[model samples]
Target: MEAKKDNSGRITDWRSYERVLLPSIKDLHRLDVYEENGGYQALRKVLVSDDWTPAKVTDEVKASGLRGRGGAGFPTGLKWSFMPPVDPEVPRFICCNGDESEPGTFKDRQLLEYNPHSLFEGILLACYAISAGTAFLYIRGEFADWITHIEVELAKLYEKGYAGKNIMGSDFSVEIVIHKGAGAYICGEESSLMNSLEGERAYPRVKPPFPAQKGVWGYPTTINNVETLAAIPTILNKGGDWFASVGAERHPGPVLYGVSGHVNRPGVYEYPTGILITDLIYKVAGGIRNGKKLKAIVPGGSSTPILRADMIEGVRMDAESLKEAGSMMGTAGMLVMDEDTDIVGFLRRITHFYHHESCGQCTPCREGTGWLEDIVSRLERGEGHYRDLDLLTDLCTQMEGRTVCALADAAAWPVRYTVERFRDEFEARCRPSLVPAGISI
Candidate 1:
């Protein structure tokens, strides 16, 4: 695993890095294979050991600096600590979000498909920590095959006594239920997912009664992303400090960088956090397709603010660095655009997605998303006016932060950022305003 690096000491070869989330072991999804690779040892250690407790587990994860991989990047341990003290009379639940519905995000699917036991084990660990008897594993409905695969593996866990009734002959008993989503993008949101789980329409719930306080059927619940939970086993196996030492000081540990768009090798590459954007596009993903100059990037998923190529000159793929770089480390689903890319058309497509995915509960999101798509589509079709540009930005301002969920903000971001970053391209497509810039209608 000797990595070739430039003078800056950044690993130029992604292969040199050892993978944690997506390990190299063959058939690692199988219970025996996962067990052979040291799976569930953390669960057994925690459940059986006198030295470990729920608080200690939470603290260890806090020390690891692991953040939510499902767009938000909040501290996982801190989220775990939010669960109220375990009450034997009252039940708590652990919801594993496997709804990888974001357009550019596909890494969670691999984890569910290739190494599900880790997730199952992680779910079990979460149940113990929260003092919950039941855990719900929510997966996207489009992943029918993967859902079936997980079901088979889950049955194996039950057969081996790793799940249901008792675990490793200990007092702790847990049951995992697999709930398949209807492929709604809004269901990816924690509250919306909970609502959908409770047999209600998938709409993002209002806050204050946040999932921590009241969740899925009115139980104190802790919802974690699939990748976030999968990382738990490794963090517990290799001490949290060791996990913290692997990547960037602020946001550490291995991340499944799902690089897509105009790249020679557009696939999920497992590397430590804070990998230079250039190192990922050039070294890991085998550089831009056909050696074209880099144009722009949606550094996270489609929801994150888009960045011009120049803006990402020294950017690293971590939450802190990306924030400084004017974007977010959203799902680490980097969408690379080549120099010849159509900015306006790309924005049109993105706006369409958010518009279609809006749950319609929020007035701002439901209407605003539609307006965004209509405006972007108008520009793409060569019927937009120069005034439409200002209108788009204005619409974004009105839509952003006005909805119950971030979908409005998500829809607004690309419209605002793309128009601002690549205004020239948009201006080229638009007709001049009918009146002077200062004139009223």
Candidate 2:
């Protein structure tokens, strides 16, 4: 595939990247060819080379300006550096978050499905950089097919001496274990994920003595998104500066954007940051599936605020800038809605997800999510009154800042933003009328 942007707006690069990333993603099913295509070269180099130190790896990553691709876009190297100084007495580990459950975001699954060794190598290198002896890949339980993909690929990697004890015949070691989560959206959050991994119902925990200070059985454990770890090999192998150039200056690298809904070719595309949202939906996805008109979009995942068609101009695919646009670049889940889409019905469906997924550990999120969904359901069915909108706003405000974690805030952001931007449509349907007493609302 050519690396240049085409007239169609779809990225014409990954077909060629497949050649370069062969065995990694290029020749995935063929294990021997994977090795022949330079699969474990990066890990071998890092493990055997005396010139590079853990500090050097961390410093280079910091210089690269690579942020977490999961959503928040926190600097990856900075987060890894938060690991407390290696304590021989205390157990230290790194946990790779492969639980990709965000709505409209399935890009991470492709990375894990088609080319899992990239993630494996990345995880091993992360442990090596942080001096972690034991690392775990926390994969979501729903990925039944990819579980076999990962299991097979991992066994091949282990046979190649890329994993298990004493890798590359060196003194350093990182024993990787694959643990699965029992389908929970909250498990995508790091703390809640840790909880689920520990054989309990996934729920948020208090912070301040954050996960870095104590985690995973009360040891210093590092949790990073699967996509975050997948970027490590390329960054270390090609130099951080090169990796930084792949995307926009703020959040650089080839972001795997999952563009779905009302698009012709709705799938994941690897592209540089700052690509116009219009180009992505229209050009890349073949212009909204058919002759339909574009309406609004969720630039990030569902947690982000909505952006009307006019608002997508010059929107860089970065973190801070997306926040400036009254949305977040969350999990790179780009959902495009068509003009004929029912805005009320949409919110009803999304609100249902927030309510069902709420852990109920906290009062505001547990109660508030249910309230938001009830209001949305009523409004969708044309059974709501005008005062209900005010009630919705007030309830969302109450839940926004009072939860144990950001799940409550996540539920409220879209509810508040959808009404704020599209009140006319909602009010048109939801406003109560004392018409005929015989007629149903």
Candidate 3:
């Protein structure tokens, strides 16, 4: 597990940040090869060196305007600040949420599978920022390979004096433990993840005892999403001003967008915020396969509302702009739909996903998601009563903010947007020229 340290060596561009992006073809997919590069340098830079104070790091993050890439785009620095500042006697903890389970989002895996060291670097940087000495990486169990991959990296750090007690010849020390979740999407929720880490149900707890003040074995902890932390070393290596300069004014820094569903190029793209949806699809992804015209798009992941292609002008890569557009830049999961995609059918598919993922602890989310999915499925299959549209919208209204967590609210946005904005198309779907036998024509 001893990774050879080489701080001077580097790869170029986005790959420059990734192990796969390493110059040597021979090192491709090899575990030890990653450490040979400047893998743990950031960790060493923070804990090993006394150059930058934790407060200085926090200020830079605030300047960067780096919002969380996981669903809610809450400012990362603000979240860190929310925690009770360092207590000399009390120990603080930080956990990196690596469960990339959100539908249409798979970018965290890229960071794990290719540029794991970058993620590891960010993890250590967060520990230093919060004055924390203990960190946990809650990787999704489905990605067992990543668990193995990062575990090896963690071991490498420990053996090389980058992790464990008395790290980097300093009194300040940090240990990162890689924990595997039992594959529940709810575990992505900070509280739920904390609960799961402690061998409890995945259902979310009501907020008040925010994870910052009381979390993970009852200690002040800072829980950060993977992509949120992965962007750190770059912020450190480059200055805060440099980090802020990369993306849109409000939401700065590069976003690894996972374009999927119906598109010509269905993979990851690392571009800065404010990347136009049209350009992301048309220019970068080469538009839909076989010259299909754009129909609707889910600007973020399935949680965000469905947006028409004409709404492209309003779509911004930042959370503020996306929120203004009646959706969110949630996890930057862009699902491009062609003209052939049925709006009703699309809703049905997403409804199923949400329904399946709902923790069922919140009554509203448990019932509402299922209700929405059932109704949407019926509507897509030409089983609509016109009254059902109003029913569905009402169902969403009940779900929004009525539940313990935003999961219910997340379920509601899409249904509400689809019914209000695209009612005609949905109603038309119910009355096809040749309806199936059981459904009313």
TM of each candidate vs. truth: 0.96, 0.93, 0.89
- Candidate 3, run of 10 with poorest lDDT: 9-18
Q: Tell me, what's the RMSD of every candidate?
A: 2.6, 3.8, 6.1
Report how far off residue 300 is in candidate 3 (Å): 1.2
lDDT of 3 by residue, 6-76 (tens): 24321112322322222234443343665565555656676656777888788888888888888788899
Which digits, one per residue and each the tens of the lDDT, describe model 2 over residues 203-306?
87788678888888778888988878887877787788867655466777777888988888998887766667777887777888678888999987898999
Q: What is the lDDT of residue 59 in candidate 2?
A: 84
User: Model 1, poorest ten-residue lDDT window?
Assistant: 4-13
Instruction: Estimate the TM-score for candidate 2.
Output: 0.93
| Range of the 10 consecutive residues with the lowest summed lDDT in candidate 2 | 15-24
lDDT, candidate 2, at 330: 91
Which candidate number maximizes lDDT? 1
lDDT of 3: 0.79
Candidate 1 vs candidate 2, lDDT winner: 1
Clashes of 1: 0
